[model samples]
Target: MEAALIAFATTAATLSVTVVLALLEFRRRRREAVQARREQIVGRVLDTLERATRAASRAPIVGWWAPNELEYALLLPRLLAELPEQDNAVATWVARRIQHLQAATSRREQVAIGADVAAKVVQWGR
Candidate 1:
């Protein structure tokens, strides 16, 4: 009877450890998945912004009024808000550029802001 009890206790302890390890692994994987999704969203926003910048260069005034520009302007704030505060320098830089772009009143100012944003996005890729 004592031997049986010892064996049962050993088995229970092993199972408990396994359960704990599995739970830890699950949590880790979930966090990684969330980070991956956030990165994907950030990439999309950057790509869109880059494309809009190119479009803006073609026609400084008309490009600012383009559909792509409007879409990017609408999406940037929400994406910037979603980014984690830590290790988010690129997001922060983009946010500042967006603010500058929004505050721009002249075509030359808009073009300059677009070029600056494009340069930062290129730098971030490295």
Candidate 2:
């Protein structure tokens, strides 16, 4: 009886560990997929905005959109919600400041804005 109990306990322990590891791996893969989706969305946004700016004969990082306006900021939530993924909080946050991207007057400011937007890729799938 004692040997049987020990064998059963050992099997249970190994199965539990296997289950936990599998769960963790699934979580990690899901996270990576979400991040990839967000990066794709951001890329699309920047590309579209750049094209629009150029077509309008405006500079991408300067004077394409008005700067520091509370009114234009209101469009962010709508834009984010309209996306296929409604839970994209990082994209929502980015949309909040996106209009102002073209407001940067200097090259340094443009670079900073670019870097800040790029860094949001790691924030979350949501």
Candidate 3:
């Protein structure tokens, strides 16, 4: 009977450990999935922004002539919102750039802000 009890206890301990490990692995995978999704969103937004900036630079005028600001403004805020609280500097910089891009009064101002935004987006990729 003692031998049987020891075997049962060993089995129980092994099962418990297996369960704990499985749970931990599940949690880790879930976290990684969430992070991947976030990065995908950010990447897409940045790509769109980069394309917009390129288009703007090639255009004759830089004011509201660029048709991308409306879409960019909408997408950028969402990306910023998804960023972790620890990334406040990035969030703040993007927010300020978006605001400046939107409020730019002259063609020169728009061009300058667009250049800054392009440079920042490139930096973020690294």
Candidate 4:
């Protein structure tokens, strides 16, 4: 009877340890998946902003705004707000993007000026 009890206790301990390990592993994997998804989203946004900035670089002197540049400028703030603040790298990247886009306000192009005004109008209002 003592031997049986010992065996049962050993089995229960092992099972408990295994369950704990499995839970830990699951939590680890879930965190990694969330981080991976966040990276993918950030990458997609970077590609889009890159394309828009490229188009905006060729902005005309007189217009309400160059559509692509305007889009890039406007999306900066929303994207900054949308990303999780817990990730320092993401926050740093977004800060740099905001700085880069701020150059629009300094450009001589009318489209750039319009982009600045539009961004101010839409973003500053809130």
Candidate 5:
């Protein structure tokens, strides 16, 4: 009876340890997946911003429908939806970039030249 009890306890302890390790691994993988999704979302936002900037630069001031603004508007929802919690800075920066793009379009003015810098800084965290 003593030996049987000891064996049962050992098995239970080992099972508990295995369960703990599995849970830890699961948490770690979940974190990594979230991080990867965040990075991918940020990257796509950066690309859209860059493309809008380029479009604005190349677009003429006479047209009411700036292609860049249209494209950006189309992408805004997806980008906003994917933004992670506690990423207010990035969200704000993206908003500002969108505002600038729209303002430049509405005013029929030439696009700003610093879009790349803003996009890069946001993306690379530099």
Candidate 6:
């Protein structure tokens, strides 16, 4: 009976240690995943902003309007993707700018301005 009790206690201690190690590993992995995702999202937003800026700069200025269109399909997703979830003020500001850009006839010019607006949001968020 004494030997059996000793074995049981030892096994329980070992199991507890293993569980703690597993939990720590799981938390570490989750943190890594979240960090990686944030990096990816930031990269994508930066890329979009860079592309739009380049496109706008390269576009022909015609009668106070840029010739190039703002390619909503490309811009919207990346902007929304980079936008953090918790900040309603930032989100609303961005949403309003996007709405204006979407409604504008000179989308390229609008998008360039939008990038400035987005940069402000990024600054605020950080």
Sort the candidates on TM-score, descending order. Answer: 5, 3, 1, 6, 4, 2
lDDT of 5: 0.65
The segments of candidate 1 whose C-alpha lies over 4 angstroms from its true place after superposition are 61-69, 80-94, 104-126
Tens-place lDDT per residue, model 2, 1-126, is 999999999999999999999999999999888777666765655554444333334454554363433333443554476456656665556765565565767545655565565555334434
What TM-score would candidate 4 get against the native?
Answer: 0.56
The global C-alpha lDDT for each of the candidates, from Candidate 1 onward, is 0.71, 0.58, 0.72, 0.58, 0.65, 0.63
- lDDT digits (tens) for residues 10-99 of candidate 4: 999999999999999999999898766666655545565555555556645533454555565666666666566665555455446455
Distance from true position, residue 89, model 5, in Å? 6.6
Model 6: weakest 10-residue lDDT segment is: 63-72
Best by TM-score: 5
Model 4 has an lDDT value of 0.58
Model 1: lDDT of residue 71: 60
lDDT by residue (tens digit), candidate 1, 1-126: 999999999999999999999999999999988767666765776677666666656765676457555766776777667666764776777777777776778756766787777666555544
Q: Which candidate is the best by lDDT?
A: 3
Which pairs clash in the backbone of model 4?
none
TM, every model: 0.63, 0.51, 0.66, 0.56, 0.70, 0.61
**Candidate 3 clashes between residue pairs 3 or more apart in a chain or in different chains:** none
Compared with the true structure, what per-residue lDDT tens digits does model 3 show for residues 1-126?
999999999999999999999999999999898777656756766676666666656646653566766766677677767777777677678778878876877556766786777677556645
Quote the positional error of residue 17 for candidate 3 in Å. Answer: 1.6
lDDT against true structure, model 2 = 0.58
Q: Which is the winner by TM-score between candidate 2 and candidate 5?
A: 5
Total backbone collisions, model 2: 1
Please list the residue runs of candidate 6 whose C-alpha ends up more than 4 Å from where it truly belongs after superposition: 59-69, 78-93, 99-126
* lDDT tens per residue, model 5, 1-126: 999999999999999999999999999999888878877876676677666656555636634464755776776677667766676566666667666656653323434433543555465542
